[model samples]
Structure formats: structure tokens, C-alpha cells
Target chain A: MPSNIIGWARLIAGVLGLSAVAYIAVTGNYLLTALGFAAIYVVFVAALNLFMGHAGQVSFGQNAFAAIGGYGSAILTANHGWPPMLAMLASALLAALVALVVGQATLRLRGHYLAMGTLALGLISYEIAVQWEQVTGGYMGISGIPPLSIGGFAAETDRQVFLVLALAAVLACWSVWRLRRSRFGRAMGAVAGSEEAAAALGVDVARTKVITFVAAAVYASVAGSLMAHAVGYISPEVFGLHMVVVGFTMLYVGGIGTTLGPLVGAFVIGMLPEVIRGFRDVQDLVYGVVLILILIRAPGGLAGAWRR
Target chain B: MPEATLLLQFLVTGAGTGCVYGLVAIGFCVIYNASGIVNFAQGSFVMLGGVVTYSLWHALHLPLAVAALGAIIVSVALGVLTDLLVVRPLWHRRATMFVMILATLAVQIVVERLTLIVVGDAPMSLPPILSRGPIHLGPIVLDTQVAFIFAVSLLLVAGLRLFFTRTATGRAMRACSIDRDAAALLGIPVSRLVAVGFALSAAIGAIAGILVTPTQYTAYNLGVPFAISGFIAAILGGFGNPFGAFLGGLMLGITQSLATVAFGAGTRNVFSLAVLLIFLLLRPQGLLGTAKT
Candidate 1:
């Protein structure tokens, strides 16, 4: 069989498997709701991979962008009567613009400084979200968000929301795949490998860094919008600093810098709460242990393990 | 009613929190200097100090002084463990700075979750270590606890300054921070000092935690915000300079307090983030840190 045919076959099989999971989840409303949430995280983690895996910058502040996207769309749809989809798109673009500015400002920082700078940005964004109570509803959060709709069809139920999330996740994965195969993707790898060498080789290091940062921001924004709509509520607490750490955990567990890693990581970590439900108190403990163990034993992540 | 009293009140409270932040920031400086790895778990150690002391004193009915000591020991051990289990292994593996930083985050997660499990997630507090009631001096009114926190913070900073400059082990640690390879060549136990660095850092954080717990509520998650504030404070004063971190923390505290007046209470936290971002962009070396050659 041709290699492309094999790849297409695998993609079909994966989608079919996901559809089967969705079908089973539909019978159990709670499980479907959980999976719907997982799908949103899948998008966030995949977007993260574009930066960490491909571009090689660690953003401890992507959660801030997620909040931006979440709050941006939530406010518009909740207050202005704009369509949910349009609001999501606009918020994502806005997030990208913000990322562009932040990227230009801080991308020059090397290693530790860059990480700390992003962490500070995340803290600042969360503070802003909480303090801007007039818009974000403060700690109470904005509620009664309209369900995402298309051409008069609304996804009012968990099953429908799950379908939308899955579609979005698939699209995100597809786009990321295309991105990794592009010249820009190669440039990102070059930049990550050695910025000095990449510059020597004529790659625009700063521009590539900013573009990757903006792309990840846009991805997080969309994820946030979906989350706000799916839950019908959004708040600062939902996208706290923990999300940044958790998102990074997912990327690491699935295998950093791999196409399949994000989905795998998201699925594992997403379902993790349920898996350890019997030990309610140790849920986070389990996650912490898993994260450390993965980093130590298999820095390449689960997907990397599978390949091995 | 003197308006100056109100200003003094904010300044006093600001100084109290600022001093605690200074302590934590010094911890950041110590570890960052020694290992060149920012331990995100530094705050978790702070949380551990408070929660552990609270449990020892309140739950076990131990003496306050003894309970504080127990907390210090626990924090120091955990600090060493952080080095032995997390940092050293990763460092030996030749992990990237990104990976090492992530390792610290993992330690943070583990510490926080385990703390919640052990402490039952409730906000606990210690009985005031100082006398109750406010002391009025001219137009200023201050709590005894605030005075204790401030005085202790300054003493710790002075003690650390002497230790780093005057003591042999401390100088060894300082030498290691400056040039690990050279320090090792000079017969300094570089790895051991790194472990010592973690322990000392955690001890300072624990001290701050215990001192502040008399006036502040202790919770499992409080360490994160404290860690963040301390981090900004450290950066503001320069990453590895204890004195710089001390001054930075004080400035940050005062700014935050004043920001409450200017931007309302809700917006105060953003001040540190703003300060951090601006400093990082324009002068990453920080206020007291000399320009890197």
C-alpha cells in the first residue's frame, strides 16, 4: 500500500475510534460532558505543541490568552447579542494580536527570563480578569451564554456540544499537521534547534518566534471560547495558573513536539479525574506523580513510547 | 482624624506583607544564584511551613516555638529532597533549562497536592506570636505582629548577608553560584552547596511563612500567589541578589498598598506583574543588579 494511503487509513481509524467513544458517551450524559471538555483541552494542548514542540518556546502564560479568548467571547455574546461563533473568531484574532505584541516584547528574552516573563503575564491576566468585574462578572463569572449555533441549529445538549468540540479538535489537529509540514514549520524547528544558527542560515528568528507565539495564542483563545459556550459560564477561576501547568503536563505526557502527543496527553489527563475518582483526594497527587514520572522516564511522552 | 494615620496604616500593613515577600524573594535569590534554576516550588515550601506548623501546634498541641522549628526542619528536608530527587537527576541528564524549570513545577504540584491531602484543604491559622492590640506612635498605629514580621525580616536579611560574605560554607555556595566549574576546581563541594542552597532557601521561606501566619490565614494554595509575588520581587531587585530582592519586595509591597488606593483593592495584584514586565523588558538586570557584562 502507498504510504499516504496508509496515513489516510490511520486517520480514518482514529476518527472512527473517537466517534465510537462519542457514541458511547452520548448514552451517559455525564461522560459525554466530560469528553466535550476534554476536546476543548485537546485543542489547547495541540496549540501548545505548535509553540513548545515545533517552535521550542515554553509559554507558562498561555492560560492568560485562554482567559482572554474566553472572556472576550463571553462578554460579547452575553451582552451584545452577537453570534457565538463570530464572537469566538473575533476573540481569537484579538488574542493573536495581543500575542503578537507580547511576543515582540518578550521573545528576545533567553530561557529562564522568557519563562518567568510568561508566568508574570499569566498572573497579570488572571488579576485583570478578576478585577475587571464589570465585564467578567468578577468571581461570579458570566453565565447564561448562548449555545453555539449554525444556521439556526443550536447545540443545546451535551451530545451536540461534544460533536462540535470533536470537530474543532480534528480541525485543529489537521491544521497543526499542515503547519508542521510547511516551510514555516521547518523554520520553527530551526529556530528551536539553534536561533543563532537559524539566523546565520537566513531564517528570521524573531519573526518566526512571534508568529508561533501568536498561533498558540489564537489556538488557546478558540479553546476558551468553546469552553465558555459549552459550559454556559466563564470565570477567572476556571483559567487560573493551574491551567498553564496542566496544559504543559498534557503536552509532556503525550510526548512533546509530536503530532499525536497533544491528543494523547489531553485524553489521558482529561480522563484522569475519572480514573482516580475512587481516590478523590489524590486526584491532583496522581497527576503530579504522573507528570514527574513522565518527565523522568519518558521525556518523549506517551506517543514517543508507542513509537519505541 | 489625621489623614496621615490612614496613609501610615497602609504603609505599615504594606511593610508587613512586604517583609514576608522579601524573605521569600531572598529564598528565590539564594536558589537561583546557586543552581540557576527557579524553583517554582519555593512557594509550596512556604505553604508547607505554615500548614505544617499549624498542624503541629494546633492539631498536636505542641509548643509554638517547637512547632515552628519542626516546620523549619520539614521545609529544609523537602528542599534537600527537591534537589536530590528533582534537580540533580535532571541536571545530570543534561536536560534543557525548560525541562529543569518544568521539573520544579512538577515538584510544586506534588508538594501542593500532598499538602492539601495532609492539611485537609481548610484555611488554618496560628495564634498570634506577638501581643494583641495596636501600638500607636504619633499618627501611626501598628500591630505587634507587624513589627515582629518586619524586624525578623530585616534580621534574616542581615544574617544572610553576613553568612554569604563572612562564612566559609556560605562563601562556597556563593562561589558555586558565580562559577560552578571554578568553584569545583577550588575544591568546593558544588553539588552539596547546591543542596545547602535549597535548604537555606526553604528555611528562609519557612521563617517567613511562620512569622506571617500569625496575622494571615494559612491555606494550601496561598503559596502560589506568594511565590509569584516573591518571584517578581526577586526579579525587580535582580535575580540573585538577596539585598536587591529585599528592597524589591519592600518597594513592591508599598506599591501594591498604594495601588489599592489608586486602583482599588481588586487591582492591586497587577502592580507586581506590571513592574515585572516593565523591568524585564527594559532592565532585566534589575534595580540593584549591576549590568551583566
Candidate 2:
């Protein structure tokens, strides 16, 4: 098959799959929640792809930024009566600041050390979310969060909320696509290829990694805030290590380096539980098996396979 | 309790758990030395050790010692399987470090899920191998279980020392860790040694699980915490040093126990994680490890 034909096929299939979900959500109520969550994850996975796939760095703790963004948004809006948009922006800034400090500290380390450091960062954030009862409400979580709104227009209904989230997801993907074509993106590719070579070629390896890490954190933070507004509830469990696992699954299954990989991967993986809802007890087992098979068989991921 | 005595009690308890952490850290060292792969599934072996033993004893009515032995065998087999089925293929293909990490993580999740399916999610425990009561030593009180942990750990450490120093295979394994290409050129069965390393680590993790499960409960979800703590211990001991890992584990365990007393139970993980971050930044070479070239 010609390469363009394969690309077209993927495009059509993605559009159709997304349209089917959108139609179901618009027509009925059952799938709305799942669709909303999937949209949020789309943003999350795309941002993760920027750091992991493009930048060629490992971070087991992107969820830390997400948690920061989430708790920031939740607290600011729920307690301080701030508007949702302002709260979301504040949360994103906070996550970016955190990513800056943490990235500078950790990105210097090579390979496993970097991975371990990031993992620790994430677990520590989770511990705080659970332990800080006064702010986070502990396991009970903060509830009654206001719905996302802009300029006095609030997304109150499920359909409206899903639409807004879908728009954000699309914006996230589009930005990632644009960024991939930019000079900075190419620099990230260089860093991923070989840090020493990239450094020798004047790539400022450390700065590129830290910048990308911060960008990814901002993406995760925005997604976190979106999740808070969409669900109207915030809890530590929502942004735990499991989120990292899920993000990885989506990134790998969808095609990590590819532009549309996050969307395709997030949609497929996000709805997988619903697809296998009947096998409740075996969901995680099935996920693990599927992930392993994908790694072995389609190492480049579904998107990468499609391109080939 | 007097302040000093309470502190002493906490230290004793911490040391007991620290022994298990040391064992787990040693397992990490073995695999890392043989192959560059960091098996995130290491904790799953520990979980299996306790959970499998409980099932064999409680559900199948096996003798306690037999159950424990059976659990170790099963865990070792799984470890071998992990290497053969998961790590080996990825190793052969020269999968990126990220892929390898993700693959091991998947293995961990699969093992945890399988354990949950087989044993259910409720926590399980083994009856104490030794007598039930705490042994009072003047002002300090020590649980018999803690004593057993120390005894087992000391024996294992001594045995490992002898093996490394006195055995042909152990020396070859060490050679491979020092220089894999050189060892391979010299006709060491590097791949097989990697499998053996996995098996050794699995055995150590299982023993730790069995020893510690009597004092606390074991559940399918406990694997990640143990994995995190063990990884910290590994880093603290310097990446690939077995003895360093042991010492690191003891330090981590005691610090965590003290943190629990000083702050609260929930902050224990926070303290350890803080220690991990601080150590990673300031002392990446670890306590006993020389700077990497």
C-alpha cells in the first residue's frame, strides 16, 4: 500500500471512531463521562509524548505536575471563589514553576537515575495529596467544584462540558503538531538521539530537556484542571502513579513520536475498559498483556506501524 | 514508655523491617550487576512470597515450612520466567531503556493482577515462624519475629559473601558485572548469568516477604511500595553494590520508622521519598559506591 493511503486510512478511522463516540455522547448520557475523561487524557498523553517521545527523556513523575495543577485548580476555585479559567491558569503556572525546579535538578542525571528521581517526585506528591487533609480533604476529596466557565458562559451540562474538553484536547494536539515542526522540536529530537552529540553540536542539551519538561508539565497541568471542572470533584487517587501507567499505555500504543499518536492511543486505551467492561476482574491483567504484546510486536506503536 | 526506651523500641522495629528492605535491595543489585535491566517486578516476587505462602498454608493446608519452600520455588520460577519471557526478548532486540522500564512495569502489574485474581484482594499473613511474644532485654524489648529477621538476614548476607568469594560461578557473575563484553569474550555465559541473577534476586525478595509478612500483612497492592523502598535502598547503597544495598535498606527502614513516630504514619513514605530525592541529587554515588566512570 502507498504510504499516503495508509495515512488516509488512519485519519478516516480516527475521525469515524471519534465521531461515533461524540454521537453516542450527544444522543445518550452513558458515554458522556467516559468521553469527557478520554478528552482530558488526550491532552495529558500528548504532553507526555512531547517529553518522553520527542525529547528522549524518561519521567515517571509527570503525574506530579498534574497533581499540582489539579490541587491548585481545585483549591483556588473551590475555596477562594476564583473563576475556573483564572484558577486553571494559576495551576498551569504553578505546575510549570515546579517542573522548572524539578527538571533542572533531575534532568542532569542519566537514564535510570532520572527515572528513579522522577518516580520519587510523583510518589511524594501523592503522599502529600493524601496527607494534607486541611487543603485536599484527604481521601474524601474536595467536592462541589464549579464547572468550567469562560466569560460568564459555564459548561454546566454534560454535553457542554464534553464539548469544551474536546476543544481543549484538539488545541493540545494541534499545538504539539506545530511544535514538532519547530526548531525547538528538532533540538529535542537531537537531544533524544544522543545527548553528547547534541551538546557537541551546540544544542544546549540541559536547557532543551528542562524546557520540554516544563512544557509537558504545563500540558499536564491544564489537563488536570480540566479534569477537576469536568468531574466537579478532585482527589489524590485521580492523579496517582496509575495515571503515569495509563499515560504510558496511551503514548506507546498510539505511537509515541507521531503527532496523532496521543489521540489515537488515548481513544483506544481510554475506551478499552468500556470495551472490556464485562471482564471487570481481569481488566488490569488484560491491559498488561496487551501492552506487552504491543511492545514486542509493534514496538514503534500502532501509529508507527500504520506509517510503515 | 520513656523517651529513650520508645526510641530504642522504634529502632529495633525499624531494623527488623530494614532487613527485609536490605534483602530486596540485594536482589536489585544482583540483576543490575548481571544485566543493566532494573526489574521493576522485583517487588511482585516479594508479594508472591508472602501471598503464595499464605495460600499454600491456609487454603491448601500445607505445612508452614513446606508452604514457605513452595513459595520460594514458585517465586524463583516466576523470576526466571520474567527474564526468559519479558527481559530476554527486549534485551535481544536492544530495546531502549524506556521500553525496558515499561516492560518490567507491565510485568509487575500483571503479577499483581494475577495475585489479586487468585488470592483476592484481602490482606494475607503467615503465622510467626518463631514464638509470639516480645523478648525483653533490659530496657529494650524485641519481638521474636524481629530476631528471626535479623538471624535470617545475617545468614543470607554471609552466604552471599561466601558465594561471591568462593564459587566459580559467583566470580564469573562478578566479572560479567564488571565488564560484560570482556566476560563474554572470556566465555562467560553472560545471558545465563543474567537469568541466574534474576533467580537469586527473586529468592531474596521472597525470603524477605516471608520473613516480614508475619509481622505485618501482605496484599497484592503492596508491591509498588516495596519496589520504591528497595530502589531507594539500592541507590543509597550505590547502584550495584550488594552490601551497600543492605546497609542502605537498614538506614531507610530505620529513618522511615522514626519518621512515622515523629510526624505520623502517613508521612513515612514522604520521608523516604524525600530521602531518595535528596540522595539522588547530592550523593548519586551512594554511601559505599565510588563515583561511576
- Judged by lDDT, which candidate is best? 2
What is the alpha-carbon RMSD of candidate 1 to the true structure?
3.2
All models, DockQ values? 0.61, 0.64
> Isolated chain A: TM-score per model?
0.92, 0.94
Ten-residue stretch with the least lDDT total in model 1 chain A: A1-10
Expressed as tens digits, the lDDT of each residue in B13-64 for candidate 2 is 9989999999999999999999978888899989999999999999999999
User: How many clashing residue pairs are found in candidate 2?
Assistant: 0
Give the Cα lDDT of each candidate: 0.86, 0.89
Proportion of true inter-chain contacts also present in candidate 2: 0.61
Interface RMSD of 2: 1.7
How would you encode candidate 1's per-residue C-alpha lDDT over B252-281 as one tens digit per residue? 888898898777887677677777778987
> Residue B206 in model 2: shift from native, Å?
0.9
lDDT of 2 by residue, A43-109 (tens): 9999999998888889889899999888899999999999999999999999999999888888888
lDDT of 1 at B125: 90
